[model samples]
Target: MQEWFVDVAEHIADGDPIYLACEECGQVALPPRTVCPDCAGRSLEQRPLSETATVTAETTIFSSTPRYAEETPYTIVIATFEEGVRLTGQLRGAETVERGEEVRLGVESDGDHWLITFTPSD
Candidate 1:
């Protein structure tokens, strides 16, 4: 993985979810980059991601690799945070959600691996 990717994973694993916002263009980047993707600026700062998000898109998976076979019929969601950055994660502990539904951001860990999760807030 890219070093930046590891840095982001570590930050979230440490219980502080963060995103890099570009000072130049007001663009937020999750899984941060050293330079601003929108404006090619180098002034990016780490900011905490809001704990809540609104579902913007969703998909259901009926089949999967062995690791996730038991979790089939699961849903995935793309949620938009207050800062306007969108994050995609597995939606858990709730029925499939619609666009505009509220959800709580979370990180699910299986010791050696981690997955992002969004649970319905309502």
Candidate 2:
């Protein structure tokens, strides 16, 4: 995994999530980036994420490799933040969710790694 990705997760675990915004084109990216993907601008800043996101897509995985078999039947969602950045993460606090549903972004740590988590907004 990318170091920047881990950094973002760590921030979330600490109650702060961030998105990288381009100082030039105003484009935003969820995972931190050194340069703007749109304008190739090197001036990017870390901005606090909206924390809440709207579910745009979802799916449930019933089968997976042995490493993830213990966590089978998990739900994954693609949620859009207020900044227009879409983030994909594991769904928590519910077995499933629908499009347009509200969810809060968070982080889950499992010893050596961090993962993005999306739980019901309320």
Best by TM-score: 2
Task: List model 2 lDDT by residue over 87-109, tens digit each.
Answer: 89999999999899999998877
What's the lDDT for all of these models? 0.84, 0.89
Span of 10 residues, lowest total lDDT, candidate 2: 107-116
Per-residue lDDT over 41-60 for candidate 1, one digit per residue giving the tens place of the 0 to 100 score: 99999998788899999999
TM-score result, candidate 2: 0.95
Candidate 1 stretches greater than 4 Å from native: 1-15
Total backbone clashes of candidate 2, pairs 3 or more residues apart or in separate chains: 0
RMSD of each: 1.8, 1.0
In model 1, how large is the Cα lDDT of residue 108? 68
TM-score of each: 0.88, 0.95
Model 1 whole-model lDDT (C-alpha atoms): 0.84
